[model samples]
Target chain A: MSDTPAGGGAGTRRRGRPPRTESADTRDRILVAAREEFSEHGYEKTSVRGIAKAAGVDSALVHHYFGTKEQIFEAAIAVAFAPTLNAPAAIADGPLDGVGERLTRFIFGIWENPTTRKPLLAIVRSAVNNETAAAVFRRLVAAQLLRRLAEQLGHPDGELRAELAAAQLVGCAMLRYVIKLEPLASADLEQIVARIAPVVQGHLTGP
Target chain B: MSDTPAGGGAGTRRRGRPPRTESADTRDRILVAAREEFSEHGYEKTSVRGIAKAAGVDSALVHHYFGTKEQIFEAAIAVAFAPTLNAPAAIADGPLDGVGERLTRFIFGIWENPTTRKPLLAIVRSAVNNETAAAVFRRLVAAQLLRRLAEQLGHPDGELRAELAAAQLVGCAMLRYVIKLEPLASADLEQIVARIAPVVQGHLTGP
Candidate 1:
């Protein structure tokens, strides 16, 4: 049996590492490194070894934490989308009539958060560059985020409507934050949400 | 000064070389080579020498044709967007009431065209991956395409609305063609356009 951490040995416990209090910390470290690597090099070029190296851990340790590169990437994206995903529920708890304003505000607030925005930019950039990254991004948007948004709206074509809403929101982010187009780029977040939210709301609940 | 082709020296012209014709051919060749190079290797990895080699021309010829890599990329994108730029006019000439169908057909036609689609995929991929590429793409979309669509629509918020329409079209393309998601990936073009065009036209014409 090979002594390497990644290679499983006969009669050895499948879970090699004993549970540690710092398990979450190690997982987060791997995620951070993966985000940076994926952002800079994209999915096709980014390797597990490379992420492991960046995280200052053995490749096997990375596998121990995330299992595979795709799994790690999914986890990273889940984390990235969490704020937006959770926002709808939070906004729903508020006034239903002001859903548009609340939704837009929630979106802009999350995007304006630097910690969230930077990793998101990386994911967005990487997704555009590589097919694999794009697939992951699309899945998250379609399955998790858009699906939830559609469920909230409860329209007949809610899925499609939700996707359109997402496209508008994401497209604005792409231009303002990632691409940094003029005028729109410099516009205040509040101004943007105020202007655009109605359109999003119309899509969500219009006839 | 320097005798290199890129330097544009004032020395005696070569006899019987047909400088103008050769230069034009070189420029076209470089653009073609650049499209393929950028598509395959992306903007960062593609080089002038590599493009020149692909074109079977001298490196100096590439520089002479296009001043820099950035200029070449811009030219390539301009070429890619050309199909869409002319599309509005073509669709405009058709029945005004069926503008949505005409527009949808035109967009799907271009995206379905293998010749155009490959380079487009490259451009989109690069734009998503690299900041420079994203900036260039955003500028092209904003200035040329979105502005024209807005002008044609003659809406009060034409610019923003046009951008919103563009986001729908581009986002769908990104998912169907680039990401190759289920259902959308295999769905018939007519069905997709039928479903999507009204939404797009709504953004353009408004109720």
Candidate 2:
């Protein structure tokens, strides 16, 4: 493998160093530990050392895998939100007219599955509680998810449109899944889709 | 004024005890203390003694005024959200067809003002982080704001419709004000209303 930098600079020294197997297994182990530590202690309380301890790895290894607590939180979010990364594809594959229902259904489907919902609640709760965590969440949702969704929109205000639609769905998730507000929380899934799908479509394709 | 108990009952005894001027001034001071305590120490770390100390009152006085920590949080939220209590009136006083724009504009108007929005941020942050705080926040929003708005809608699903609309605005607040996400956060007020008011209307009156 070429550890050779095309042009030698400050970056070259780090690149020239041998990879210490920031391998998939090692990364996953660290991320799982990070998630557990975050869940048990919250963002303010969780530490890199604590996460390393949980992962049964040295503190240096944790830092090597992820640079900071915020970065680690971002990494954990990326994994938890992995299924949603497929969402833009779903929109692109569908007929433009049907994008609304498809996108709405797709998002709700992720939350309907308990496996996805729990971690989402954790990250969302973190985002609400801490600015550093919110910044990571904001960057990930924008860079990874919403930007693609915006591109699929194909409008002058595509970015705005995507965010508007996101605000709608995010609100639903907060009330239904997180806060569990009555009536909306207890409402049938179909009932929500029937009402909300058009709004999603409108935000995507409407004024 | 007569502290008269017409009937000898458990509730009557409490009613017969003269009002200690749970008067506006005393009540306001206790709530200010509560908000300050919750803001400084957060929900878990804050205590009745802390609030009472901060208010320069006895713990018993704090109990007499608000009953418990959760109750104090509720009272604080109620005070913070007082401006919005007038909101149902905004929907009621306006023409039925224009309810969406008026309602959206009115809600945003409250948030637009820093005076009202700061305490709102405090209470909402508390709600997201603490279940006990969340419960108080939920109960007040439901009872004070949404219920009245639901009545104005006059639909079979008026309660559901009201909740759905609340979710929409709440999500925007989370993203725009709380998370401060791009585009949506920077988007002009009218732009939001133009896009969101119709969606809000659709929730209220649409099929």
The best candidate by TM-score is 2
lDDT of 2 by residue, B55-129 (tens): 888999989978978888888878888888888886788678888888888889988898888788887777776
* Alpha-carbon local distance difference test for all models: 0.73, 0.82
Off-target runs (Cα >4 Å) in candidate 1 are: A1-20, A94-101, A155-157, A188-191, B1-22, B91-105, B153-157, B182-207
- Point out where model 2 deviates above 4 Å: A1-23, B1-26, B58-60
Worst 10 residues of 2 chain B by lDDT: B1-10
**TM-score of each candidate?**
0.78, 0.86
**Candidate 1 C-alpha lDDT tens digits along B1-207:** 112345443455455553455456567778888988998999888998999899998888777767888888899878877887776687767655676667778877889999878878887778766778877887887787767766777777777766655656776786677766555667778767766677667666764
- Candidate 1 local accuracy as lDDT? 0.73
Model 2 interface DockQ: 0.58
| Residue range A1-207, candidate 1, lDDT tens digits | 122444344555335654333566577788889888876777778899999999999999999888888888888778877787786577667655677778777877778889888777777777776667777887887777767777887787777666555555766676677666555677667766765676677666766
